[model samples]
Target: MESTHHQFYELFEQLGLPSSEQEICDFIDRHPLPGDVKITQAPFWTEQQAALLKELLKQDADWAVVVDHLNVALHH
Candidate 1:
């Protein structure tokens, strides 16, 4: 479990931040769904996104949405 935590954190660290909303959205659109996906796992990623968003966008729109954009960029 701890390894998984570090892995994800490292993943976010490597991703840095998204340049724009469209970049994020495009990434998300292209991202593939997990084989065993579930909504309950959503919140687990929120914290990571918020953390990255703070580092990247700073005083931008809602952190969650910014993170969503980032996710999009990362996936797509």
Candidate 2:
């Protein structure tokens, strides 16, 4: 399956993120399916994706963990 950052950028490009951070926030808030969550089947995801998703789901924390992952992916 594709990694979260790849999925994120794909959605970002699709949604035209340049409009505003609000747009990005709304997009993220909408909670697109992770590669693992098949609509008609059981869950499936790699260890890395699951771990990252766990962190991503932890809102109300000080830092933006999902953005951190995206940054790491971008640098690599």
Off by over 4 Å in 2: 1-7, 10-42, 60-76
TM-score of each: 0.28, 0.26
Q: Kindly give the number of clashing pairs for every candidate.
A: 3, 0
Q: Residues 1-76, candidate 2: write the lDDT tens digits.
A: 5433334544345323533557655644554555554322213334554454456445523234444454343333
Model 1 segments more than 4 A misplaced: 1-14, 35-76
Cα shift from native, residue 16, model 1 (Å):
1.1
lDDT of 1 by residue, 2-36 (tens): 32122323334445645355554454565554635
- List pairs with backbone clashes in candidate 2: none
In candidate 1, list every pair of residues with a backbone clash. 27-72, 27-76, 28-72
- How far does residue 70 in candidate 2 sit from its true spot (Å)? 15
lDDT (Cα, 0-100) at 22 in candidate 2: 72
How far is 27's C-alpha from truth in model 1 (Å)? 0.6
lDDT of each: 0.45, 0.43
Q: How close to the true structure is residue 7 of candidate 2, measured as C-alpha lDDT? A: 44
